[model samples]
Target: MKIALLSYSTKPRGGVVHTLALAEALAAAGEDVTVWTLGRGGDSGFFRPVDPAVRQEIVPFPDVRGEAVGPRILRSIDTLRAAFDPAGYDVVHAQDCISANAVSRCVRTVHHVDHFTTPELIACHERAIREPFAHVCVSAAVADELRQGWGIRADVIPNGVDSQRFELAAQDVPGLSRWRSRLGRYVLSVGGIEPRKGTLDLLEAFALLRKSEPEMRLVIAGGETLFDYRDYRTRFDARAAELGVEPVVLGPVHHDELPTLVAAASVFAFPSNKEGFGLAAMEALAAGVPVVTRDLPVLREVFGTVARFATEPAGFAAQLRAACADPGSRQAAGRDLAAGYSWDRAAARHVVLYRGLLG
Candidate 1:
């Protein structure tokens, strides 16, 4: 069957990552798969190279300087809608709010639900959830949220991690040495200084953690998003200054270098206020790095006993300290958990769902 998977951007956001990986896996399983995404910021392809077997349809979405996010989002919907013809595919799956809103009919994947204040965005989010014929959630907790909030039932399909890639990175002594030489004894966070990412919370946690581990650095990587977080960034910078802590903000690390970066971390901190499945944390786990995540049900469901769970700054600081000092069997347990999430299994489940929908 011909399958079309749509996402808002060609960046390395969790949802986009899920789309690309799922498409490749489906293609590998002898199914015709295509991934459609908006090539934002002069990008002609994904952040990383995709499998040759899966077709790519990157709709040109040039940047508009000084444009408000609301207007830009609406324009993005209009532009993608104009370019994408849904009639050609047997299964049309929309991966995010923008793509879901633009398409006439789709199987929407509610990776994580968000609350929007703007009227247009609120409406768009509502329509995307309500209009989609079928829905998928990466965690059962997210599916439960969909059911409780909108009375919408969704299929729960967890994300698949590239366990081998990160596992190999852990074993790459030279690669690990390079990253460790660059940033020594660092507590790492992936997902930038956005409000949803709980960046200020991380700042506070890092400052507190520094009290004990004075020489440890706070290293943050990856901040590619369609949303403008300048205001939140301003707040984050101010808080970092107030707390007398400086962090190494390496925005958007290269795809090939990311696994090594993950492997080199002393401890991984993911104090996100919200998340779908905590994919970045999982990648760190796969790399044999100890991970501490925000105490969210979805993350709890995904990580189980493999990850240390925390809520606020103090909690996060405490967990990070424990993770760094003594990871124990959690590291091995984490590797096992990460390896269990296979893209092949996820793709086969998707095929079953798609066929069920077609029938």
Candidate 2:
């Protein structure tokens, strides 16, 4: 069977990563897989290379003249892509809203719902893409949101971590020696620096936590998101300084190095107000590190009974403290939960879904 995946931007975002992983998994199971997307900055003018087995094509959509490109440009590219690649694959999987709106049927499309907020966005989404034959939500909560808000039902397919890439050792060993000496027992949060990611809330919780746990540090991984990166960075840096919470913001570490960073942490703190699925928390759990997240439905669904959930900032701070105190309990629980989550299993699920669609 041959499968084609469509998305607007195939950059190294979480959704893109998920698509690439699924494509690789499908290809590994003897399906011919092809990915289609637009060209991005600093990348080769071809399919964003993943597995050698997977084929990719990039439709160039460059912003011409000194003017900014918006919906018109995207629509042009989408029109061209849809017209050119209509009958090549057995199933066409569209990741986000952009790709979903562009392609029409007899392509068995899978639209992944990462988040469902804003009625305007929903209306635009419906107007843009043809209703998919099937939709996949990373968590049950996400599926429920689509059902409740948009009147769309979707299948629940939790994001799976590559356990081999995120295994833990006997102890928390800092792989990077330079930062290892300075960075001691800290709570780790990995995501783009954005308010929706709850970076500000995490900082607030950490400020309160530092009053009791003075020696504790907060290690933040990844760079800025949609907002003004410069302003957000300055404000966050200043807040940390003011609170005297030793904040280490390492901008965008390589995905390969994430496991070591996660394993080195005492606890993984994810105070995200929004999430399609808590991949970082799952990764931390996979690395045998305890996780403390907010009372979000998706987090609850993904972590189940293994993670500590807090209703408020105070509660979150307390949970973090408790998690830090008896790290072994969380580690044991995490190891147990992490056992079932693997990219192999996730890939196999994709293979089944694709085969079923083909049949």
Candidate 3:
């Protein structure tokens, strides 16, 4: 079967990560697969190298200064739509709003539902959900939302973690030692400083967390997005200064180093207001790191008893403290949970969906 998986950007966002991993897994299962994406900011390929078996088609998208989020989103849709041709592939699947809008008829993976006030984004989100021939969601909670809001029934296929890679990184004494030496004991969060990520809330929690654990630092890494968050970033900077907490903002850490960084962390903090599958937390779990995430139904559905949960900054701080205080038991459970999700299993399920559709 010929399959084309689409994503909006070449960045390390969750959807893009899913696209690449699923493509490779499908290829490994003896299916022909290709990944299509927009190469924003001169990115010629994905943040990390993908397997050679799966082909990549990166449409060059040059940077446009002063482009607002609305216009940028529209342009992203246009650029990918203009470049992509769905006729050659037997199955075309879009992994994000932009890619779903780009193609006329295809399968869509609704990783999560976003409530957008902006006109363009609202329309794009609506069309992406309503027009797809079929839908897949990373978690059942998201699928339930789709059913409640749009009366759409979607198959639930959970995300897959690269468990061995992270588990190996946890065991890599030299790599872990190097990161520990550089960053000290720290709470780490990926996905950049954005409102949706609850960056300010995390700053507040980190500040409170520091009252007791002064030796531990706060480290944030991996932030690449099409939308501009300058205002949120400005507020974050001001709040960090006000709180007198200096967080190590390592923007876009090298992909090769991510596993080690996750492994070396004292705990992984996922304070996002919204999430589809909590992939980063799962990766941290694979590294045997304790995870503390915002208490949300989706998170509870995905993580179950594998992680600590909180609803606010104070609660987040308390959970972080607890995770740091005694991580051994949670670490074992987290590792087991993370190891249970397999990319091969996810791919096999997808292939079944595709064949069912084709029939």
Q: What TM-score, over all chains together, does every model reach?
A: 0.99, 0.84, 0.99
lDDT of 3 by residue, 228-328 (tens): 88999999999899999999999998888999999999999999998999999999999999999999999999999989999889999999999999988
Candidate No. with top lDDT: 3
Model 2: per-residue Cα lDDT over 327-355, one tens digit each: 88867678768767766677677667767
Q: Which residues of candidate 2, in runs, are more than 4 Å off?
A: 45-49, 59-84, 106-123, 128-130, 168-179, 224-238
Name the regions of candidate 3 deviating beyond 4 angstroms. none
Full-model lDDT, candidate 1: 0.92
The better-scoring model by lDDT among 1 and 3 is 3
Give the residue spans of candidate 1 off by over 4 A: none
> Could you tell me the C-alpha RMSD of candidate 3 in Å?
0.8
User: What does candidate 1's lDDT look like per residue over 176-295, in tens digits?
Assistant: 999989899999999888989988898998899999999999999989887889999998898888889989999999999999999999999999888988899999999999999999
Model 3, 167: alpha-carbon shift in Å? 0.4
Backbone clash numbers for all candidates listed: 0, 2, 0
After the best TM-score superposition of candidate 2, give how far the Cα of residue 96 lies from its true spot, in angstroms. Answer: 1.4
The Cα RMSD of model 2 versus the native structure comes to 3.7
- lDDT to native, each model: 0.92, 0.70, 0.94
TM-score of 2: 0.84
Q: Which ten residues in a row are the worst by lDDT in model 2?
A: 106-115
